[model samples]
Target chain A: MIDVLTTAWNWIAEPLQYGFLRQAIWVSAFVGLVCAVLSCYVTLKGWSLMGDAVSHAVVPGVVISYALGIPFAVGAFAFGFGATVAIGYIKSKTRLKEDAVIGVVFTGFFAFGLVLVTKIPSNIDLFHILFGNVLGISRQDIIQTLIAGTLTLAVILLRRKDLLLFCFDPNHAKAIGLNTQMMYYTLLSVLALTIVTALQTAGIIMVVAMLVTPGATAYLLTDRFDRMLMISVAASVSACVLGTYFSYHFDVSTGGSIVVLLTVFFVLAMVFAPKYGLFAQRFRQRVYKKQLDEMSSPP
Target chain B: MTMTASSLDITVDDISVTYSNAKLALYNASCMVMPGTITALVGPNGSGKSTLFKSIMGFLQPSQGKIRVGGFPVQKVQKRQLMAYVPQSDEVDWNFPVSVFEVVMMGRYGYMNIFRTPRQKDRRIVMESLERVGLVDFRNHQIGELSGGQKKRAFLARALAQEGKVILLDEPFTGVDVKTEKRIIDLLLQLKQEGHTILVSTHDLASVSTFCDRTILLNQTILASGTTQEVFTEDNLTMAFGGLPISSLRQMTGQMTGQSSHIVNRQTSQNAEVEA
Candidate 1:
C-alpha cells in the first residue's frame, strides 16, 4: 500500500513531470466539465445529436484553418455556429423535422472535412481529429479551455429558467415574451464554443461521448436538472482522472481511455439506476401492477 | 369577470401569415377579442386557426398585417409576464422531470431573475394558482405521474401562475375525459370572472352554444364568426362544415333552437362593453 501511494505521489516523478501528460490531464479535466455540463441541457432538449454534429462538422473548419495557417479555433467556431443556425433556419423555412436536417448536414460537413484533411500533406497526423492525443498540450490551451468553459457554464447556470423554458415549450416561451430566437441562437453559440474547447482535449471523435454520454447517463439516474448536471460533472471528472491514470499505466490514448470509462459507467447506469432505468423500471412496474390487481380482485 | 362584455382586449388587424413555402395560412384576418369572455376560435384541421393564434403572440411574424393586445401591437406587449399560452399535448413532452408546482412556477420566470432565488411571493402565487386549478393536493407530485386531465389542470395552473390579463389556450380539451372537460370549462368560467381575455381554439362546436361569447370559424379563412346562439345555425353549418350540416347533425354535434337557419349577428361587440 505504501509503495502504491509513493508511486501515485510520483505524479511529481521526474519522467512524468517533464512532458505534456500533466498539461493534457489538466486540460482534459476542464474540457470534460464544460462538455458534460452543457450536454445536460442538450440531452434534455433531445438535441443530443447536435453535439456529434457540431464536433464532426468542425473537422472541415479545422482542416481548412490548418491549410490557411490560421488558428483552428476560429474556423471551428465559425462553421459550428453556422451549422447550428442552418439547422434552425431549415426547420423554420421547411417542414422538415429538425433531427432529419441535423443528420444530413452533419454527415455532409464531416465528410467534407475528411476530404479536406486528405488534401493536405499526408505526413501530418490527422488521427488527432478522430482520436485526440494529449501529447501536444500547452499552457495556452489549458488557460483558454478553462476560461471559456467556466464562463459558458456560468452563463448557462445563471439563465437556468429561461433555458429550461426554451427547451421544454418554445411556443409557450415565445408567448411569454422570451426571445426564443435569441435564446436559441445563444444556446447554439455556447454549445459551439464548448464543443471547440472540448475538441482540443477529447478530439472530434471522442468529444461526443464527453458531451453526451455523461449527461445522458446522469439523466437516466435523476430527474432534476440541477442534480443531473452535478452528477454529469462528477462522472466526467471521475472519468478524466481515472482514465488519465489508467492510460499512464496501460500505455493507451488518454481521450479514448476516458471515453471507454464513461461507456462502462453508462452501461451500469442503464441497468441499475434506481428509477427510469430499464431494469429498475420494469421491476417497479410489475410490482405496482401486482399490488393493483390484488386490491381490485379482492382475493 | 361578470363585469362587462365589451372591454377591448385582443385586436388582429389585416393579419396575414404566409409560410416560406408560399402556403398562405391567413390573409387580412381581422377581429377583436373582448375581455372577460371566452372566444372559441373554431376551424377544421387544415384551417389557419393555429397560425392566427401563433401570429397573435408574435411567434409567427405576419406576412402583411398586425396583431395587437389592447390596441397595442404584439411587439409593444410587455415581457414574458404579459400572456400565458398552453399548447396541445403533441407539442409537449410528458417525460420531462418536474413537479406540478415547479411547472406552474415556470409562468413567473420572466419576472424572476436568472440567478436570483424564488421569493415567498412567487411561491404563494404558485400555490394559489394550483388551488385555482384544484391541484393543490398534487403540488408535490411529479408531472409525469399526473393523469391526462390532471396534466391539463396543471397547465392551467401554470397559466394562472402567470397572472396575465390575456391567455391563449390551444386545444385545452383535447384528449381529456368528459368530466375533466366540464371541470376545465368551469375553471375557464372562473378565470373569466377574474377578467382574463381568453382565446380558445377547439373543434367542439357545442361550445359555440354554451360558453364562448363569440366563435371564429376558420377553414383557412374565417368562414363565419359570432356568438354561440348567433353563429350556430343551418346555413353557416351548410357553408362551413358542408358534409355535416346542422339539420343532419345529431344532438351531440350541435342543436338549433328554432327555424332560423342563417348565422346570428350576435351583436357580440355591442355586448362587450357590459356583460352583466
Candidate 2:
C-alpha cells in the first residue's frame, strides 16, 4: 500500500516540475472558479443554452482578433454581446421563441467564424480556439484571464441581491424601482465576459459546460442560493485541478478532461444529492406511499 | 426605520398600452385608488388587469395616458421607495433556491446600500413583516417548499418590508386556500387602516365586497369605478365578465349567496387556468 501511494504521489508531483503545467493548472482553476460563479446564475436563470450560444458565438471574434493583431478577449466579448443583442432583437421582432432565436444566431456566428478562419491565412489554430490549449497558455493570456475573471466575479458578488431578484422575479425588481432592463443587459455582459475568461481553458465549444455543469451540480446539492454558489465554486475548482492532473499524466485534451470531470460531478449530484436528486425523490415517494398504505390498512 | 405612514393616491388616467406586437392590452383605462382604502380591480382574463398593474408599476410604458401617485409621476413615487408590488405567482420562478427570509428581504433592497447588505434595522423590519404575515416560523425554509398560500404571504411580507404606502398586488388569492385568503385580506385591511393605499387585481369576486372599500370594473377600459356597493353591481359585472355565466355574475353581485359562492369558486379556478 505504501509503495502504491508513493507511486501515485510521484505521478501527481512529477508534473509540477514543469512551470507551464503549474501555470496551466492554476489558470484553468481560476477560469473554473469564474465560470462556476456565473454558472449558478446561468443554471438558475435557465440560460444554459444562452451560455452555449454566447460561447460558440465568440469564435468569429477570436478569428477576427487574430487577423487584426489585437487581443482575442476584446473581439470575443464584442461578438458574444453582439450575438446576445441579435438574439433578443430577433425574438422580439418575430414570433420565434428565444431558444430558436439563440440557435439560429449562434450557429450563424459560429459558421461565419469558421469561414473567416479558413479564408484568412492566420497563425491562429482553429483546434486550439475550439477545444483550448491550456497546457501551452501564454503569460499574456494568463494576465488577461485574471483581470477579466476578477472583474466578472466582483460584479456578480456585489450585485448578487438585485441579480437574484431579477432572475427569480423580474416584476418585483421593476416594481422596487430597479431598472430590470439594465440588470438584464448587465447580466448578459457579465456572461459574455465570463465566456471570454473561460475561453483559454475550456475553449468555445466546452466553455458552456464550464458555465453550466458546476452550477447544476450545486443546484442539486443545496436549496439555498449562497450555499449553491459556494458548492459550485468548490466542486469546480477541484475538478479543474484533478482534470488538469490527469490530462498531464495521460496526455489528453485538458478541456475535454475538465468537462468530463464536471459532468461526473453533475451525475453524482443528480443520483445522490440529499434533497432534489433522483434517488432521493424516489425514496421520498416510497415513504409517502408506505405511510398512505399503513393509514389505509389500519385507521 | 423608513416605515412612514405617508400614503399616496394612485391616479391612472386614460392609459392605453399597446404591445410591440400591436396587441392593445388596455385602451383608455383609468381608475383612482385613494389612500387608506383597499380597491379591487375586477376583470375577466385578458381584460387588461395585469396591463393596468404593469402601467402603474411603470413596467409597461403607456402609449397614450399618464399614471401619477400623490400628484407625482409613477416613476417618481417608485424612486422614493413608496411603491411596493406583489406579482402573481405565475410571474415568479417558485423553484428558485431562495429562503423565505431572503425573499422577504428583497423588499428592503431599495433602502439598502449599493451592495445590498441588510442593516440591523432592515433585518428587524423583515422579521416584523414575517411575523405580521404569520410566516416567522418558516423564515428559514426554502420558498419553493411552502404551500401556495404561504408563498403568496411570503411575497406579501416582502411588500410589508418595503414600507411602501402604495401597494399593488396582482392575483394574490388565485391559488391560495380560503384560510390563507382570509389571512391575506385581514393583513391588507390592517395595512389600509394604517393609511396605506392598495390596488389588487383578482378574479375572486365573492370576497371583494367583504374587504374592498372601492371597486373598479374593467374590460380593456374602466367599466365602472366607485364605492364597492355602487360599482360592483350586476350590470357593471356583466360588462366586465362579459362571457362568464350569468349565474356566476349574479352570485358576485347578489351578496355572494352560498350556492352562488360555489359557482364563483369554480369560476375563480377556471380564471386561474385562463390567466396562466
Candidate 3:
C-alpha cells in the first residue's frame, strides 16, 4: 500500500517538473473553469444542445481559417457566433423547433467541414482539431487560451445575476426593463467565446461534455445558483487536473480522460447527492411511507 | 404616499393584434384605465384579454392603432420604468434553481444601472415585498419547492418590488388557493390605495364586482368597460362569453350575493346590492 502511494505521489510530483506538462495543466484548468461557469447558464437555459451545435459548427470555420492562413480563433469565433445567430433566426422565422434547427444547421456545418478537409491539401492537423492536442500546446497557445478564458470568466461573473434572471425567466427580465434581446445575444456570444477557448483543450466533441457535465453534476448536488457555480468550478478544475495527470501516466487521450472523469463525477452526484440524488430521494420516500403507515394504523 | 404624476392612466385606442398564423387575437380593442384604480379585465378563455395586456405591456405589436400609458407611448413608458407585468405563473419555469429572494430581487433590475449590483436599499425593498406577500420566511427556499399559491405570491412579490406606477397582471388568480386569492385581492386594494394603477386579467367574475373598481368585458373587442356596476352586468358577460350558459350566469349572481352557499339561489337579485 505504501509502495502504491509512493508511486502515485511520484507520478503526480514528477509532472510538476516538466514545462510542457505544466503548460498543458494550466491550459486545461482554464478551459475547465470557463466552460463550467458558462455551463450553468447553458443548462439552466436548456441550451445544452445549443452548446453542442455551436462547438460542432466551428469545424468549418477552423478549416477555413487554416486555408486563409489566419488565426484559428478568429475563424472559430466568427463561425460560432454565426451558427448561434443562424439557429436563432431559423427558430424565429419558421415553425421548426429549436432542437431541429440546431440539428440541421450543425450537421450541415460538420459535413461541410468534413468535405473541406477532404478537398484541402493544407497541412492543417484535422485529428488535433477534432480531438485536441492539449499536451502538445505551445507558449502562444497558452497565452491565447489565457486571454480567452479570462475574458469569458470575467464577463460571466460580472453578469451572473442578470444572466441567471434572464435564463430563468426572460419575460420577467424584459418586464423589469432589461433588454432581453441584448441579454440573449450576450449569452450566445459568451457561449461562443467559451467554446472557442475550450476548442484547443477538449476539441469540438468533448468540449460540449466539459461545457455541460460540470454544471449538471453541480445541479444535482445543490439547489442554489451560487453554490452550484462554486461546485461546478471545483468539479471541473479537479477533473481537468486529475485527468491531465492520468492521461500522462497512461498514454491516453487527455480530452477523453477529462470527459471520462466528468462523467464519473456526474454519475456519483446522481446517485449520492444529498437532496436530489436517486438513492437519497428513494430513502426519503420509504421513510415517509413508513410514517404514513404508522399514522394510518395507530392504536 | 403622494401619487406621482406618472401614475399611468392606460389608454388603448382602436388597437388590433393578429398572430403570426393570421388568427385575429384582438380587433380594434379600446379601453381607458384611470390612475389609482384596480381594473379587472374580464373575458372568456380566448377573448383577447391577455393579448390586450401584452400589447399594453409592449410584448405584442398591435397591427393598428396605439396604446399609451401615463400620456406616453407604451414603449417609452416601459423605457422610463413606469410599468411592470406579472405573467401567468405557469409561464415561468419553476424548476429553475433560484431562491424566492433572488426572484423577487429581479424586480429591482429595472431600476438598477446595468453592471451594478443590488444595494442595501434594493435588499430592504425585496425583504419588504416578501413580507407583504407573507413569504419572508420562504425567501431562501428554492422557487420550485414552493406550493402553487406561494409561487403566485412570489411573482406578486416580484411585481411589488418593481415599484412601478402601473402593474399588469395576467391571470394572477388562476390555480391559486382561496387564501392566496384573498391575499392578492387585499394587496391589489392596497396598491390601488397607494395610487398604483393595476390591470388584472381574470375569469373569476365574482371577485370582479367585489374587488375591482372598474371592469373591462372583452370578446375580441371591448364589449363593455366602466365601473363594475355598469360593465359587469349579465348582458355584457353573455356577450363576452359568446352566450354564456344561464347556469354559469346564475352562479355568478350567487357569488355577487356574498352568500356562503354555492348553489344558484337567485336569478333576479338587485344589481345595486351586487355592486361594490
Using TM-score as the yardstick, the better of models 2 and 3 is: 2
lDDT of 3 by residue, A1-299 (tens): 99999998899899999988998898899899999999888888988999999999988888898899877778888989999999989887888878899999999988888898889877778788888889997666667677777889888878888888889888777666678899899999989889889888898999999989999999999889989999999999999999999999998999999999999999999999999999999999999999999999957
TM-score of each: 0.89, 0.94, 0.93
Candidate 1, pairs of clashing residues:
A10-A13, A176-B80, B1-B192, B4-B275, B5-B272, B5-B275, B6-B272, B6-B273, B230-B264
lDDT of 1 by residue, B50-146 (tens): 8988887778788787777876777566473556788777777777767788888887776777653789988999998898788999998878888
- DockQ of all candidate complexes: 0.52, 0.65, 0.54
Candidate 2 vs candidate 3: the DockQ winner is: 2
- DockQ for model 1? 0.52
Candidate number that wins on DockQ, 1 or 3: 3
**lDDT by residue (tens digit), candidate 3, B38-110:** 9999888988988898888887789998988888887677676688888897788877888999989988887
lDDT of each: 0.77, 0.87, 0.84
Model number with the top lDDT: 2
Give me the runs in candidate 3 sitting further than 4 Å from their true place. Answer: B1-6, B253-276
- By DockQ thresholds, what CAPRI class is model 2? medium
